[model samples]
Target: MLTGTVKWFNNPKGYGFIQAQEGTENQDVLIHYSVIEMDGFKTLKAGQTVSFDVGQGPKGLIATKVLPDNGQGAKVDNTEVLEKDSSLA
Candidate 1:
């Protein structure tokens, strides 16, 4: 698994891009909602840290088995995330 930060995510669009950590081959990886492993509403927020596996998609690099970093690396509170985005709530 690779660690990275979410550059941006569109809740309604159900897609986003992750900025890979320094020294990674891919600077950005596409992340789709389907790959998120969260139990509730699966969504990511900008600046959020995460770990995931990479795979080749039809378009290009994609993130799979995405897991949110709930430890020290994570900055945003999951509840705040849901509250901030009313659409996802």
Candidate 2:
């Protein structure tokens, strides 16, 4: 798995970009909410450290699976994730 930090994530959009760790060729990675390996809310925060695998997406490099690193980064309420999704529709 590759380690990286999230650049930013839009909860309502359910997608974000991750900046890969230094020395990696794929610096920018696309991450979707579905790839987040969490039980409740599938989302990531800006600057959050994460471990993920790389895969080819329809557009570009995408995170096949994302796991938050030791629960680090900003905290978000569970309702936020759910609320954002519903708001989009």
Candidate 3:
């Protein structure tokens, strides 16, 4: 999960771009307007807290599933263990 601010949105065209908040290689996220608010376009705006998935599109990193983060930050806790003997340490 990554946090970013909406740089710009094209309601008519049905797509937008977001400037990553921090700690990401790709700074911009490509978003399809269909992923925008269903009620109306007003639901989104620049500098809004948006959480999305970074996917590899035809070009590069594109924001696939997007949603408004209600203050609580996204959780990313995937753990992997490597087995080793004490003597190796």
* Residues 1-89, model 1: lDDT tens digits: 88899999988799999998853585689999899877667888899999989888887789877998873332345697677799865
**lDDT (tens digit, per residue) of candidate 2 on 1-89:** 98999999998899999999953585589988888887766778898899989887777789888999865334676687698899789
Q: List the residue pairs that clash in candidate 1.
A: none
TM-score of 2: 0.76
Score residue 18 of candidate 1 by CA lDDT.
92
Model 2 deviation from the true structure expressed as Cα RMSD, one decimal place: 5.0
lDDT of 2 at 80: 75
Task: Report the number of backbone clashes for model 2.
Answer: 0
Judging by TM-score against the true structure, name the best candidate: 2
Q: Which ten residues in a row have the lowest lDDT in candidate 3?
A: 73-82
TM-score of candidate 3 to 2 decimals: 0.63
Error of 2 at 52 (Å): 0.3
Q: Could you estimate the TM-score for every candidate?
A: 0.74, 0.76, 0.63
> Candidate 2's error at 14, in angstroms?
0.5
Candidate 2 local Cα displacement, residue 55, angstroms: 0.9
Residue pairs with backbone overlap in model 2: none
